[model samples]
Target: MKFERSEENIGNRVFKGALFVAGGRFVLRLFSLVNLVVLGRLLAPEDYGVASLAIVVIGFMQVLSDMRVNSALIAMREIDERHIDTGFTINMLRGLLIAALLFIFAGPIADYMNEPKLEDVLRVISVVLIFDGARNPAFTMYQRNIDFSKEFRRRVAATILGSIAAIVFAVLTKSYWAIVAGTLFGRFTEAAFSYWKIPYKPRISFREWKVFVSFGGWLTLSGILSYFTQTIPQLLIGKYLGASPLGYFTIGRDVAQVATRELTGPLVVAITPGLSAIAHNTQRLRTAYRKAQAVILGIAMPIGVGTALMAKELIAVLVGAKWLPATDVIVWLGPTLAFTMIASATDGLAMAKMATRAMFNRALFVAVVSTPVFGLAIWQGDMITVVYALVFRMFLQTAVNMYFAKTLIGDSFFSPFTSSWRSLIAAAAMAAIVSAVPASFTPSDPEYVVLLEMMPRVLLGAAVYVLAHFVLWRLAGRPDGFETKMLEVSGIALGKLRRFRRTAN
Candidate 1:
């Protein structure tokens, strides 16, 4: 599966990779939907809150410790087995270190959060990091050549199977352990699949230790700052507000994030190989980065804003009335995710150019400036105040990152307002039109009725967004961007289809 990176039709490869990854993620999200529907009912907010405690702790460790060597591998012009071994060794060492730390400090973490149940959970969840460390680093080789088949197969199969195990465990145990079980099973599956599929023996060697430290130093710093910026508010919420409210906040955030990330994250992944291929050419990389960011904003805004508009209906349909406390959380998270996701493109550009200090600065600004402000809000107000402060921080970060991204992207102003203007207007129009739909649902009626009403609004919102985009594109004299790129591909597809039909006849 490890093939030489192809220089042929890089754009097509990026598009196809995006579609392939996005398709796999789509299937994965369906399984997640099943889990949400089933688990949302089976578990309480407190159970979810407790589960978030273990997750955030592990995630904090993983993020802070990440060296991003795989990313370096993808961008490198050439790599060998020694490089792979070095990456693996670093991962394994980091995992064991994190595991030992968490094991020793689980008591203190639980004591701080005032959740006695969390200490046991953190100890058990530490096993997952071991599996994560053992994952096959060679899989990234496929991504370098625009090959996502192995990734697609392994992730989809693992998620579907893991979802089944989690549901069954939930039904039997009816505890937060089900969440822990699912995470463990998923990581184990990924680790086993990597070894089974790649058939490579990684060793405990750091022959390319200097190369890794050189490339990943800034990456590691950026990652730690990024993790702190994201997790600080959640940690504060758990400390000040308690587990139950944290549960509501996390659940709402998860649902909102899945909608935006699952759709547009693939595009970011898809563009990395292309960016790496053209890193030597400043103009092409900047152009590619700009168009990609614009597309993601255009696509994600509708998903995020529309989700905000449909928050009440979505919550009612997904989990039932018991979890209605999360409705406002989702509403706030929607627009917030829209703004924050723009940073993903800037991150990839920074990684490709090996100027990750720009990325580090992006995250560092938020972590340093926002933490005290968010802490003040947590103290003065409540969960909602903290949530609002977090949202405001992300919005500010987006603007700041845009300036950083422009420095890498060249001297042009890479403002979201300028690049994503059509999308902003289109999403606003769609939101305005869709807001007329009543958010209330009849609890006495069948659940299908809620879905039945929601179905039309979703479709109408989509139609309006597309129609608005097309009109603006035409009015702007057909600018070169994501819409143009999609159209060009569509034309090629149509031509092929027509040729095939004529030949068969």
Candidate 2:
């Protein structure tokens, strides 16, 4: 909970923090991906369908119960015992309210969804919110200080433990309850670790509740609006299309999201605090904002494009042929993932600037616009319509988010695209090259040939993308940007490594 002020360069600190977070995600998501693929093979589609509904309901309640106090604590320039205690108090109250609601509505929700098993699952998962509420708020100080290395350790350990637990349970039971148990155990581990890591005791107070509420009021509304736009697919998909189809949609969307979410999630986590550290300086904020977006898109654009191109093979190899129906959804959702990644950093920028009301307005616009389109698609009761609607919603959401973000940060609305066009073009070219590979080159179904065929194709595709991007950067006069900075850093690191090796010899 103690804060350490670093006299380091802001950009360096941000870059290092981002590296820690991204590295952690890469490791943890590998664990999670393995667990998911294994579970996908072990459990039936109906199990995921049930788990998806429970997750949506849980997320919906969590959204309604959001106070955004942790965010306020992160954004606030000054902090005190009262402020931290009030955040804890509000969290406990929010957790209790959400738990009570879930417990009471568990059966009703199960009945409404026509899934009798959800009642017990929902009740069990409700405890997660309480654990979340009881956690110390001062742990956020680590983030505010840009000490993501510690954050990285904490999250990676918890995720590994959770993944192991989930895999064990899935192997034994092969049921949706394994998913619920994994989720609950993960939250429990995180909460317990927060107190152990931070050495802060929770206390009840409302002295600073007004301050938190003042800053977080708009954010609370924004969270609620986001649930409707974001979780609507899980909520309504089952009702219209049945659990089996919803299961297909759920897995497809989950796998597709890894393309951008795993890459950008940590950067988004790092950027809010990083941007806040320099919020007073307009020039620094603008530079940091643009770089964050560029770096995220630079990594994420190729991932989305590559994943879409290899959707069929990836589903076949990773999650198995049983999930082939999910391939179409994955392909169409790729562009949506790309669009979301481009806009991911903007929310952090807005939070740093305390533009919560502007964020609320942006969310409201997306909700209002996307809701009816999503509804009409669901009304059609077809998977293709649902995919089209989801993609359309993502595009609309991105456009609105970009406009408001520009207004808040005083950047051009087209800045993201302009900064990342090279990455986009390179990714497209790489996908084309990979896709042009003849089926004759595709090896037969033995595991070795599958790895031989898929591995080389993927590697070649990635190499082409990197080479093309670099060539394009050179042709454009090698502008001073994230890619240039990354190259410089890598070169310096490599030189140090070589010198150290020579000294050791």
Best by TM-score: 2
Error of 1 at 485 (Å): 3.0
lDDT of 2 by residue, 1-505 (tens): 5654453587777777888999888878898788778888898888999989988888888888788988888887778788889999999899989999999999999999888888999999999889988888878888878888777877887788888889989988989878887888788888877777576776889988889888989999999998888888877788767788889998898778775788778778877888887788887788778878888888787888877877777776777778889989889887569757777877788888899998898889889988899889988888778888888888888888788778887889998888878888898899889889864233236535555667777898999999999998999899877578779789989999999999999
TM-score of each: 0.95, 0.96
**Candidate 1: 10-residue stretch with minimal lDDT:** 411-420
As for candidate 2, its clashing pairs are none
What is each predicted model's overall lDDT from 0 to 1?
A: 0.83, 0.83
- For every model in order, what is the number of clashing pairs? 0, 0
Record all residue pairs in model 1 with backbone atoms less than 3 Å apart, i.e. clashing.
none
Q: Tens digit of lDDT per residue, candidate 1, span 1-505? A: 4546867788778888888898889988988988888998899888998998889899988987888878988888888888888989998898888888888999999998889999999999999888888877877888888877778888888898789888998999998998999888988898888877486678889899898888888888888887887887778888888888888888788777767989998898888888888888888787777778778888798999988887767777777767778888889989789866665677667777888666777778878888888878888748888888888888878777778877886746555556668888888999898888665566655568888878889999999999999899899888877578768878999999999999999
